[model samples]
Structures are given as C-alpha cells and as structure tokens.
Target: MNRPTYNLLWRLAMPLVLARLWWRGLRESGYRKHWNERRGHYGARGAGWHTLWIHAVSVGETRAAEPLVDALMALYPNSRILMTHMTPTGRAAGHELFARHGDRFVQSYLPYDTVSKLTRFMRHFTPRICILMETEVWPNLIAVCKTRGITVALVNARLSERSLRRAGRFGRLMTQAAAQLSLVAAQTERDASRISSLGAPRVVITGNIKFDVAVPAAALARGRFLRQRINADADGDSGGAGRPVLLCASTREGEEALILDAFKAMPERPPGMLLLLVPRHPQRFDEVANLAGLRGLRVARRSTLGQDGADLDSAVEVLVGDTMGEMVAYYAACDCAFIGGSLLPLGGQNLIEACAVGKPVLIGAHTFNFAVASDEAVAAGAAVRVVDAAAMLAQARQLLLDTMTRNSMGAAAFGFAAAHRGATTRTVELLQGLIY
Candidate 1:
C-alpha cells in the first residue's frame, strides 16, 4: 500500500470534492439525483453474481456499445450481465437497454474507485471478465481487479495523440494504469502502437464498435411519425430530400460560433435550409439560444415551432429541437447534417448518426473522440472534413449546389456504416468465450 498508493485515493477523493464545490450546479439538475438514486438502489438487489460486466461512460459510448450488448445477450443467453456507467445519460441509456433482461442485465452507477467502493462493486457484480470501452482506466480500478484476478479487456480502445501527450506531461500515470488491462482491443493500429508505447501489452486492432450501429426499426418508425407531424415526408427515407433540412446537431460550447458564422455568411442562404442546432449538453441549450439571438437569427424552439407554424421559412425561428431522446427523428428528417462538437477545441462528435440515416455528413477536423469513425467515413467518401468555419461553409455550400455529390456521399456513408457491421459479432464472440 505504501508504494505510490496506486493514486486511487486521490482519484476517488477528487470527484466528491468537486461535487461539493459544484453542488449548486448539480442542485437543479435531475440527472444528479437520478444518478445518485441508481447508485444507491437500482441493480443493488442481487449483490453477488458471475456477471459479464461492461462499463461505458455516457450517451455516446452507451450507444456505441448497443449493438454489441444486443449481440452478447443473444449469443450468451444464460450469462447474467452487469452494465455500469458514471454519468446520468449513460445510466439512462444503459437502463433502457439492460432493463428488459430483468434478472439478467443489471445497470448501475459505477462506485467511486476508492478501495472500499471498488471492493463493494466487485463483490456485487463479481464479474469474471471486465469489458471497458474507450479510455476508462483508473489506477485503483485496474490494480484492484488485478488483485482480485478478474480478467479485464479494453474494447474499441483509443488513446488520442492529444491524450497521450497530456499523459506524458502528467508522468504517464494514466498510461501505466491502462497497461494493467489483460488485452487491448484497439480501434486502430495507430492506437494499438501508441498504447503499447505507453506500456499496454497485447493490443489488437478490432476496429470501432460504433461502426456497428444498427438502425432500430422502432427508431425509423418513430422518425417517420415525427417527420409526418413536421409536414416533412415521413417515408422519404433520405431519397431525394424533399427539401433542404439542415440539422446542426450535437454542437459543443465553442462550435456554435463557427456554425452561426457559417450560417450568417451564406450568400442567399439556400431556400428551405431549416437549421436545427442542438448543443451537446442540456445546460447549454439556453446559452446557445442566446448566442443565436446575438447572431441576428430568429430562434424558435422546436416545440414552439410545432405549436405555431408561423415563420416556417423566414429570418425567424431556427427550430431548436433541444430535447433529449429524439435524435433519431431529428436525424431522419435532416437532409444533410453538420455534426458538431468538432469545430473548436472539443475534438468532434458522432458523425455516425448522420451517416446512419444516410444524411450527407459534415464535420470539422477537430474530432478526436471518434477519430477512426471520422477517418473511415471520410475515406469512404461518406463525410467531408473541414478545417474551420470558412472551410465548413465552403464544403456545405458546395454540397448544396451539387446534389449529385451529396447523393453519392450519402450512399457511400450508408455503405461505410453497413459494411462495418461485424463489431457486435466480434464482441459477442469474445464475450461468449468469456462466459463459457
């Protein structure tokens, strides 16, 4: 215990401390209460089990693992599963997926990585094999699992160049922690070699699981219903976009400025260009609305836009579809989409959503979160990666002018997504191997 303390003591203490400082920030947030409730109650009934534990952080990772989780459930019918997450969005998404398993799939908030909390979590789940998505390595989490002799694997693992450089500056504790994983199923060869440089062993290239995103029939049906409600064709199915519906979705804090700039700069802004700007976080919705107002664009809440059909096409009412759980409908109606969270310092967003719906996808080169997806999409001609606001405007304008390129890109995008549909199978295979 005296040898460097594995750094978990500090890691576990920081969150509780930050939670105290930002108690006000999370005070009005329903998610805070929801996560705490799940941590305290849901999935706590069965404390001990031989479970296949999978941990994902939030909405993105949870969705990325959806296909794999379904595959695992079908492939290993007898295996009980434990799914864990830190954030409320992740907990909600996990619950939606895992709840149907009843006694089989249990979802919970991951306990803090304190010795005691980790001990409790381990005792409760008793997972023989731990599957972690992306970069979810805590020193205590890994060291304790190693101490307990539970096999652990990293799936769809990626170590960003920026993250690696930051780890180097921080004395590489993160890298050291990651090395304790038994196997690393990396998203790319570059990621594999880089993590190996950071001391991870036996890294294998498995491709990204997000590529295996399955279009739910229910989601498609729901999208159709919503599209009909909006006076857009419910069954158009991305063939011959009846109109120019531009969905500026999943924008992070800094990305909106670039989007707004491009929108305002468009000479004779293409007719029927209905912009739906959805920020990445719920808290920022009003902030982004205010920013849009400052840009001299009339803003309309999508809810309000539906209620009142005034200014459906005008300098007023850029529809704000600011609600969660409706992204599928939003994506389906969007003729083309600008996947945000990338234009500035935020890296990038899930361009996969647009691509999944066969909406011609646009992105800024700043995406580090889904690097392989972005790269593969661009390589497959399913996406256009731009450098800045100016470049984004240029690319978007070009697409607007050239319907043929947009249609071809949309087809290629769908092809790229459909072609990489085997991660769920690969993941299922490994998971079955674990349980059996």
Candidate 2:
C-alpha cells in the first residue's frame, strides 16, 4: 500500500524476475549477457569517472535519447556519460549510436530496483545527476537518488491512460516515487496532467524528444540506393514492374496476421507492390517471417542481405526486416509507411520517425501511446489513421496508386515533423537549470 510495502514485495519478487530473465535468455541471448550488471555487481567496469547518467530502458527510449545525449555532451564538454538500459537491444543501440564517441560514453544495465543493488550502483557511479528517459519509474532508484542529492529528471515523459490506470493500483508508492523527481518534462498537456496527478512535483510540457531524431544522411543515401535497386529489378522483370514498397513498422503480435491476411485478400495491388513487415521484438522475427511464408507470400529476410545491399528477388512479395538499428533506413526505402501496433488495442508504435524521413504515414485506430502526435499528424494532412486492417490496406493502396496525393502527404509529413522540433532544446534548457 506504501513505499515500504512495495519495496518488500519487489524484493520478494526478485527470484521470479530472475527466473523470467533466465527464460527470456532462452530466446534472446542478450538477457543472459550481463547478469552481474543487472544485479549491481559491476566489478571493475562499474568504477566509473563521470557522474552524469541517462537511463533509457529499451531501443525506442535509447534512440530518443540521441539528441539529448548530444546536447548533454556539448553542454558538459569534459564530463563522461554513463548510459543505462534494461534491454540488450537498447544496450546494442546505445553502442551503435555513440560508437564514434566510445571513450565519452559508458553503457550498462541499470540495477534491478532493490535497496542493496541501488546502494551499490549509486556508490559506484556517484552520479551527479540522472535523466530518466520516457516512463522508466523505479521507486528504489528515485528514492536513493533523492537521498544522495542526485538530480533526477524525466525527459520526454508521457503517461498513457492505460499506464496511468496501472500506476493507480499502487497509488501511494507511485505518488511518493514521482514526488522525488527533480523535474518532469512531459511531452504533452495530457501527459503533464497525468504525471502531475501521479504526484510528480514539477511537471513541464517539453513536447516529444522523438520529433528531434535526425535521419542520418547515410541512411537516406542507402535507402535511395535500395529503392533504385528495386526499381531496376522491376524494370527487368515484367511480372513486377511499377510496384511501390509499403513498410509496416514495429508491428506487434496479433496485428501481423491481420496485415498478411489483408494483403493476401487484395488481388489488385499495384503491379509489383512489396510489403516490408518489421515486428517490434527481435524474438518474433522468425515467427513473423514464418507467418508471411505460411500466407503464401515469397518472404525474404533483411538480415540475409550484404552490407548496403538490396539484392531482393523480384518475385518476393514480402521482406522481413529482421535487422536492428536501421529503422530509418527502412522508412526511407519505402514509398509509404504504416505505423504498427495499433491495429489491435496495442497502443501504437512511434510514427514520428516515418514522418521525420519525409514519408507519407498511415496508422491503425489505436495510438494512445503517441496520442497527441498521431492526431496532430492526421490533422496536419501528414498521416492517415485507419480503423482496421481492411481500411489500412485501402489507404495504403490509395497512397501507392496516387502519386500526387502521396507526394503532398510526404511534404506535409516533413512539415509536421519540422514544426515539432524544439522539444530537445526545451528539454536541454530544463536540465541546464538543474545541472549547469
């Protein structure tokens, strides 16, 4: 009912959590890679120099942290950053994202929320300040940081209605945990209100940091090359001439079946239409590829391609994007993008990246995870939200069939992305007051 009780329960659940991790490691090896780090026994690597730390839980959060990380690196010229992630995907993404600045950044798993581990982690890092990206709320971590006089802030903070309901189950603990946050830079007024209701002391609307993600020039170039290759293949193969590529980005479990079913039912798709199905979790990559194959589509895995190569066969109906850290490239290589996880009640995946790359975007009905951005994008003529798989397929067909409409939507997508660009700046300014 309160912090103490919650802490005790969490401790009791530790074994089950470890067992879950072990089971997950059976599928995803990353869960098994850094057992000690998760337990707060960091050994020599934990003995760090710089005190500034940023906690990004998974791949999405890690990618969103990029611009903020860049800003932090610039703001603190001589200091090193200790980046933390809960998932191995996030850890890998952190390394890939900051590979050039290897010496300036450190990546590891944030310790499990327990007193002993929290104490050890704090003593090891001695962090001056910590930035919690998105909604990574660990009561023990926050309480310990507050006790140690470490500034803890949540950047690009958001609270979906569903998340708020879940947090309400432990209202007292959540309120206490939230109250300790030095700052809550929320992405929207709705988020600010919910976070405030949860007892976050200082909440400010800073928009979503994801709007500031820059599509690398190399990604765009590679995307263009891949498109050209597809076009070349189409030209050579009469069976596949003049088709468009549609990317279904970050699809969840049940949604893939619907998408594949709709695609199969559509007998009059464009001449050589290709569907790029990218599931949200790496563990589902093989399963999704299998789904595509079972649907009688000629499926190819993106992982099989050589570096910067797009030697896909003309007969391929669907391409399974089984690779990591190249989402922007997938968006750029497509004529239109569909934001996944929304077809069911799955609270949609981020569509900001698709818009940032100047692609016309589509989404399913549910998008509460990115509610404001999705609504605004549709209002701005940059995105289309369909109620079901059939609707999504129809919209995708229209976009592929109508070049003028798609081009206009793409232009609007760029403008919409550009209009929401100052979140990173606002976030950095807020953190400056706390740390600088």
Candidate 3:
C-alpha cells in the first residue's frame, strides 16, 4: 500500500499494539511501567537543549549502538541523548548500560508510527538530528523528520537480501521512506547496494559497528570464576579434568529444540560437558529452561546460582542463562560458541561478541541477517558455518575435542575483530558532517 494508507492502517492498529504491550507486560513488567513514554509523552528533560535522538529498537540494536553512543558522547559532550526503543528489554538495557550518563541519557519507548504520536514525540524531543541504529525504516517517522528539516541518518545499517525483497512489496513507500534519509552508514558492500537500490540518496559502507564493542575485563574475570566453579563441581571426587563448556548463545524459538536434539544425538557426548543455553528474549527464559528439562537434560538456572554455586554436578547437561547483560561472561566461560538464530532460518544472531571474547564460533546456514560478517569471519578462519543441527553438533564436538584447532580459531576470531575496529570512528566522522 501507499504511505498514507500504511499510516492509516498503523493508526487503526493502535489498540492491537497496546493490547500486545499489555500482554507482554504480564510476562515482563517493564512494559507496564513505560506507558506514557510509548505514547510520546516524554516531558521537558532536554527542553531548550540540543537533544541528539537515537532509536535502537530492541536489545541487540541497543547493544550494537554502544560503541557509536560512546563516540557520540565523547564528541558531543554537552548535547543530551534521547534514546528510544520498542522493547522494554531494550530500554532497561540502555538504562543499565548507560546508567552513568544519568539524566543526560534519557530513554523512552518510540511511539507507534502514527503521525500524531510521532509529531508529539518530535515536538517533545526537538532533536537536532536522529540516528536510527539498524533496519528501522518507518515511513512516517522519516517523512516527518525530513519535513521538519531534521537531519536523519541510519548508522550501522544492514539490509539483508530477504529484507530488501520483502521491502520490495511496498515499493513506493519504501523508496519514499528511504529518500527521506539524509545518509545511511551501511555495514557492508551488499547492504550499501541494497539500501541505495531502495532509494537512499547517500549510502556509505562504514562496516559493522558491533566490531567496535569492547568486552569488559571484569566480565572476563567473572566468566573465568564461573567456569572454575562449574569445573570444580563437574569434576567431583574423581579429580578428573573439567569438561569443555559449550555456549549456545541467544538461541531463538525453534533453535533451542534443534540444538537440544543435536546434543542428544551427539555421536560422542563428552563426559562432564555443560551446555549453556541463553535464549534471545528474557520472556523465553522459563520456556527455554523447561524445554531443556523436557528434553531430559539436567538443567541449572543461572539466576538461581549463588556466587559460589559454580560447581555444577556432572549430571547437569545444560545451564539456562536466565540473566541479561552478561553475554560477554557467557562467551568468556565457553570453549566454543554457537551463535543462535541461524539454525532454523531466523537469520542468525550476532557473532561479534563471540569473536570479541576470542571464542571459536559455529553459525548455522541461514546467516542472512549477518551474511557479510559471517562470511568474512569464515574466510578469516575466525568462524565456521554449519548446515543444520547435526552439522552444528559435529563441528562443535570437533572444536571442543580439539583444543589446538579451537585455540587457533579463537585467535583468528580475536584478530578478525581487531582488524575491523575502525567502523565506529568512520561513522562518528559521518555524523559530524550532519550535525556540524
């Protein structure tokens, strides 16, 4: 449909959206807490100041924006930040991550893509410029920003082949929305081509911002501590060596089942081995934990563990990572990481964190969401791709069993990450042109 019709339909779906939020609130109470912000009711926080608005829809995008956010804060010390998110998890993550910024780092839910609400939000924030993290191409929002002469840029932008094909359905609207963007700092050559084809006037390949994320030393120490605790427990009285840890990071809905099936069918289920399963969404923590139990695997909840409760019993096959903001720790603790979302056509989750921690990564066939980076990592010998559940199991098994290969891959992963670290700087330079 056209832009006006799209807006009309979106406006008509307001009740449904609110209902969905209410339903989500039942599971994650953060949704229930930010009602006014969702309606564009943010009051005079940056009232007469130059507010630099950034929209990071959910947790992943919010995390990915961290490096860029750091650069922005350094460059524009006096300018206030108005962070907007669509998910409560994203908002909470922003608060947790940028807590030191205090009032200068404001956060709210981005309003529904309705003209009235967006106009209200625009008026409230009165931002000098807007930076969308990735893949949030709202026609209404872009059009409004353009009409108001507010510069808009899409940083760390990535347009997958699947996404571009889908956007083709709403050709005119997509093109119009793209045209409204002043600049797009795409993550790769493919993304730049796709976004330019969709009608962005200026598109530059700035590389992926995620490459710039720094893993905290504290996180690494905590991970090592956790691993030691689990090792001590799994080793028992046998004085046997601890089993290698396999981290299934950010596994999505069908992915957990696939992974568990692969684990069950392993030709060699190494003794004392532990699988750390971290679901992508917080709401699915219990569901994933239950899924593991249903698969007949002995499960331990990360949330329930005390500081010293790292010693896992040999019987415990899987540890449910029910906590948030500890991905680095998980990566640090693991011998090999299977970056989830790739196993079952969900377009794969980010593997940068795994690389950042120098862990060998195994991703599934469908990494369209991160196509270029995955391919680059594989070419760099930093990561390996598996076709499906069975292949993942086999590859993970090899990596776990073969320490030398794993270490080599891990070194490559770290090297690849280090080599790709200048994206944030280039993006910040691009933003400088727009703001200054």
The local distance difference test score of each candidate is 0.73, 0.88, 0.86
lDDT of 1 at 393: 68
State TM-scores per candidate: 0.88, 0.96, 0.96
Candidate 2 stretches greater than 4 Å from native: 45-48, 232-242, 306-310
Model 3 lDDT per residue over 1-436, tens place: 7977897888788889899989989999988987987787765554677789999999999998888888888889898788999988898889988878876788888888877888888887789999999899898898889878899999999999999989999979999899889899999999999999988999999999999988889988778766776773221111247767889999989888988888887878666678889999999999998988898888998887656654667688889999988989888888889999998888998999899888999998989999989999999999998889889888878877777788899999999999998999999998999995
Model 1 C-alpha lDDT versus the unseen true structure: 0.73
Query: Which candidate achieves the best lDDT against the true structure?
Result: 2
> After TM-score superposition, what is the CA distance of residue 91 in candidate 1 from its true location, in Å?
1.3
With candidate 2 superimposed using the best TM-score fit, by how many Å does residue 271's alpha carbon deviate from the native? 0.7
Candidate 2 pairs with clashing backbones:
none
